[model samples]
Target chain A: MGSPAPERIVRFSGTVRLAHWLLASTFFVMLFTGMCLYLPALSRLVGRPTAKAWHLWSAIALLVGIAVLLLIGNRRSLTGVVRDADRLDQDDVAWLKGGPRRLFDHDDAPPQGRLNAGQKLNTMVMLGLMVVLAISGTLLWLGERDTTYRFGGSVLTHDLASLAIGFLVMGHLYLALVHPTTRHALRGMVVGDVDRAWAERNHATWAMSESVQSAERNA
Target chain B: MTANAPTPRPGGRPIGRAAFLGTVATGVGSIALLSRYSGSVQAAIQKVSAAVPGVNQIAPTAGWRIYTVADQMPTFNAATFKLKVSGHVANPVTLSWSEVDALATETQVTDFHCVTGWSVDKVHWEGFRARTLIDLVRPAGNARYVTFVSTEAPYVDQLTLAQFTAPGVMVAKKQDGVALKQEHGAPLRLVVPAMYGYKSVKWVGEIRFDAKRADGYWEQNGYDVDAFIGRSNGLTGS
Candidate 1:
């Protein structure tokens, strides 16, 4: 018999995948709503009627997505813990110095599990940013929440948060557009699959660990 | 997972053509119903009515929200606060707060709008009208714009001579029945109900009439310059 295709690599469960896309879609909506309010140039294009409606509605949608993610993915899995992901060991240091090219093509890089340390780090950063954005955005929206619960900070603080978010978005765009292996991450989200070769090479530890667990369960 | 699979991704839908058509039809129907049900006439009036721009002040009538920033008390010291009124004038003069305040007291009640959709109505503000200063300084005939410079460096706003002299425009020293709160704008602030809140420059220290117009901070950062208070008014400089 002809050799069968290798078994598909399932990186995320159905609930996890659903939450990811929901959150991702909500992020774009929230971004557009905030831009409409912040940038008069955009406000003019949307006009007040559409812009105000879009801001309020999209914000509500963003909240819903975040709530869904929190409900589904809030557990403290080993993956959720900060330590394993945040370490910028020698390989990461080297990759940073050489620039992103070495990290892509799965060339001359250290073995990583289901998610590489960098991917984990990115996830952590994204989570933290979303939390901050949600809280600060709420304060800005609701107007003058109790000073005791103040997230308005100073005008400078608000401006700095905006700049930081802008930088994070730029970094996200760079990784998605510039890096090949991480570029595959986008397709994974869209198609809900990653090639076995891609997964084994980039996330060998994770793929191997998952397979071993499956074998144990079957045996 | 393999790149190709017959199974749909999470949250993916079949989205048949019939369903798509149904969605479009529903959306159009809802819009039509909303247009018919909602007060389009009021919206039309809000657009084309000849009523004065600040006629409907929300702050006075509605209990809108206000956030207070910590006060930088006594922002202007007669010893330190010197207003340098220069540019396109025969003689440049720097007046102290006491000197400026001693000029004719001009109070105006006008609406204030932030680009972020918050509007305060009929805020009673008191200040020396720029018109009074314009009269005193006798800006050169070509001086067609006024630039407001604040102690908070790098924030600036420019106004055309016509808008600069608009009725109820003031270099406000007070707001809402009190000496202007520091967070609101203390020492001196510009209050123009007809424009967006950023146009109401806070902590204003200097007013310069310019022969040439200059871009304000918000304008450079992609906000409208002549931010008119009508619905559907696009955010672009005339």
Candidate 2:
């Protein structure tokens, strides 16, 4: 037999992988349907009424889907993501301060826990943008019923939030799918594990501490 | 011969004038016959177009949704109506109903659109082309923007001179071969095929050529000034 398989580290649990895929799929659905509603040419292709129905229904599905997934998924691990992203330790501050240099060389980044400083910012900002979009989108839909909603700047706010979300999502895709060093990051979200060596090099503290293995097994 | 009744050239030779006149008479007779039964033709046209999706939304009685700032359409009278042409024009003359009708009649068959993603296609419109009005009241060299005031006190809109005078832009007096109904902007209304219906001010009472741009009622309330059909409304930003 070949040498024993290289030890694997659980970078993400099954629940986290499912959540990642769920969010990623919904992001595309919203992007494509939102575009249909935004561009007049596309609106004519399927008819405006049809496009509006699809966009509205898809948004509802996404909001409901996330709520249901969180309720059914591993409570500790799922909640841990929020907890980790919320609190910024000294290493996270240093990592954030590292700025542009960290993008070029991962080694310049501090030995962060499971969640990094950049990821924390991305998570917080994305959540804030979603809240803005939900409110503005609801107002825009109500504009047909009353002109008051039209005067509320809901259209401008919805469009601006969508643009910001799209920009951040593109950056996220670049790291997962295109970046040379972080290309393996996709595997953690896909298979719920990463090579022990890759984990040691990128997330030395999380891999060496075996903190994820002990805490996440219970999850 | 009437242009519509011209005979096809045979052996590369022009037809005789008498023969042409005879052909024209026949064409005239055919037109009379068609008009005698035009009711059926109109019914057929309506039947086919109404079957098409997004086409049945312009009926005055049912389809079209009327919006008025004062909760009513401004009353119009052909006899007393006057459209004042003032501001940056060399000739600031007022036109009566007869004077307005005296200008050459131009017609168009194009789609009319509302800002709310609704449209009425192939609407037959008859009016005096904007160019005719431009020639009658020559705007000053410095005049750039055009403003229109509706008979309704609060309903007003503005457009650039180029947009106001573009092809298919007209001071419409008739729609679908019928005098405009009161609800649809009777005596005269502006018809702008290039922009949404809001820019096409109804019950037009005043036309002004000004040097500076002024916001319309909707624009003052946060709507886009240049409301082009697809590219405007702040939906897309460069």
Candidate 3:
């Protein structure tokens, strides 16, 4: 049909928004704190004492916060099933080819209600990164023991993971700050509200879902 | 240009510039607070000291059996191995596989703490006490620091002689009740439970003693050197 008015689009619920922001804030803290612990230049910026304390506490908080968010949020909506496994859906491929411009040209883009393909992909990648980091990190944290579980792979694996995670974080940061359409995405996290057009253009699938529709009707 | 590289702050200044004044203020405030509340500082020191790695938590049960070097097969051959210690030191000693293994033998049951924040109780590790090696070379009287260079490409750690010699610093060769698996330090590794896992440099290849301090791989990249558990070296302000 027609594009939903900016005021009409139902963005993430208050609880969902809260959970998202909590996780995001903790993630930022963990990133900075981790950097301080891993890289000397950042550590010098904060000074070792502060870096050490912030890194440890932030990590602990991030771990606990993410756990709570994982349980509280709707996991299914976050990770949609691939209806056709062996094939790349034409819709997704078209969106991928369109890149950033399509996201802004509302009419040309798919009717994404609450989350778009790009956002969905980011969410999944981030979730996987968190799990891998948490697991490997816990192993390294334990130090060398008689345990059977190995945390870091070879030194090369560990190095590569570090680089990968660093880049992932940079990507996450870029999405938040660089992309115009997604730039407002950060505001939704902070204030727990998104303009209707944002919800419609970015997360149509989520916005159109029964849960969201039902909530909007009830509201 | 990264998608998320930090952007300029609201005041038209860089994030670094914005953080500069605040960082200095925080630093001074912290120094004041630390001096005023010496107890906290002492507590921080104690907390870090205990976090050191190589404290074996899995106590040796009736079934546990310690193995000698001769009893086990060589997990890694010395032919291709090399230990290169470089950075802020008068003598950068690069030891061959044979040389590293030959240092006076010291063994201990110690724990390992990874930066991710986990601890393994106790495992037997065999190697030379880093201090003994330093004593032999007598790092110039000015050399007050030591850094462990890991064969692990791109990761290294600098340790103060005090931290290295605090106690139970063994270049690990054995773990649990058997020879160390290749996955572990294998041929040679450092086990200093007094610090975290990063401090226990694995696949160690070099030891550089110096009068000045330098950050290890993680420290240089984004980790704490003190790496004491429970207490943050204050890398994160809050």
Candidate 4:
């Protein structure tokens, strides 16, 4: 009989998975409600008042969820992502220059850590955008409550940031769902683990490092 | 009156003095009822106008909520209302509604953009150009800014001398083909089409040309002094 298949690698912790889903759900709700408010054609379907309420509540929830995750749920994962995103070594630069084609071609692509170059760039952009959106959205809400609270060009900033985030979300979804090579990536986020073979093939450097650390611990 | 007018046969109808008297009474009674009804209708309309002032003049396309700091609108007699233009000018002048209206008038259909993410497009405004007032006052070379003071509220707004003199800026008196209502600044309100709505002060009573920049009501509260559309306040893209 063939040897038993290798155990799956734990790609995401339980806290990380929980935080990801909460954020995803909140973001989707906000996006839907925001689109209803922004598009005149869709406004009638959802109604402006209802859509506005949902959008505001969802935004608040997203912020709260992020705070909870950072402060209580999984500080280690959050810090790791943030720290790794900031440091782009030569390999990451090479990966970025090689582009997605190189990733798909699988022609000796650069070894990556927990996050690849694309994900690092995405994380940085998303972090900046989230900060902007939070500030702008709060200002907008205050302005709505009282007209006296007029912040200059805040409306434009809110609109532009929201649009950028919307596009980013779409791109992220496509990569995780539609891309042939990355379609199975969603399982890792959902189940918190990835098949050993897949992890070895896609994240060879990370897999090797994890194995070495496990060996050291065992020894 | 004919004393011997034809007498009515059985069921033929009454004639002469009694009939004439009846007809006269009916006519007077109908006239009284009509006048009373018209008076009540007028009163009802006035009550509605008092409750929701300027509801009729608001354009359907004006999609923004009205915002006022003061709970009550400032009361002013249009006939006695005076707009004083003073400070840093060759000639300081005080003009009444008639005098202001007597100057050249222009009508514009433009969008009124509030900094708070809402905009009203195609607002029809009829008023005298700010240039006409500026020409009359003739700001001195030392003047760098223009400050607008509200007549009833503790609100003030400032604009650069260049912005005040720019085209499309005016002291608007009418909106949507009717006289501007009390809630909408009544006699005169400043209109700066290119800038945010706060720069356009409502119920403007004074225009002061200043040598130095002065903070407006919002500007004093952490808002940018120069509220140019999409350009001011470090809101440009990354």
- Model number with the top TM-score: 4
Deviation of model 4 at B67, angstroms: 14
The stretch of ten residues in a row with the least summed lDDT in candidate 4 chain A is A147-156
For model 4, what is the error of residue B131's alpha carbon versus the real structure, in angstroms, after optimal superposition? 25
Candidate 3 vs 4: which has more lDDT:
4
RMSD of 1: 18.5
* Order of the predicted models by TM-score, top scorer first: 4, 2, 1, 3
Q: Pull out the clashing pairs in model 1.
A: A9-B1, A113-A205, A113-A206, A114-A206, A194-B1, B58-B121, B59-B121, B113-B197
**Candidate 3 lDDT, tens digit per residue, A24-68?**
677677667655444423333454346545655766886676566
Who is ahead in TM-score, 1 or 3?
A: 1
Which residue pairs of candidate 2 clash?
Answer: none
How far residue B80's Cα lies from its native spot in candidate 3, in Å, is 42
* Interface DockQ of each model: 0.03, 0.01, 0.04, 0.02
TM-score of chain B of each: 0.68, 0.73, 0.60, 0.71
Model 3 complex DockQ against the native? 0.04
Interface RMSD of each: 18.1, 32.8, 20.1, 41.0
Residue B78, candidate 2: Cα error in Å is 32
Better of 1 and 3 by lDDT: 1
Best-performing candidate as measured by DockQ: 3
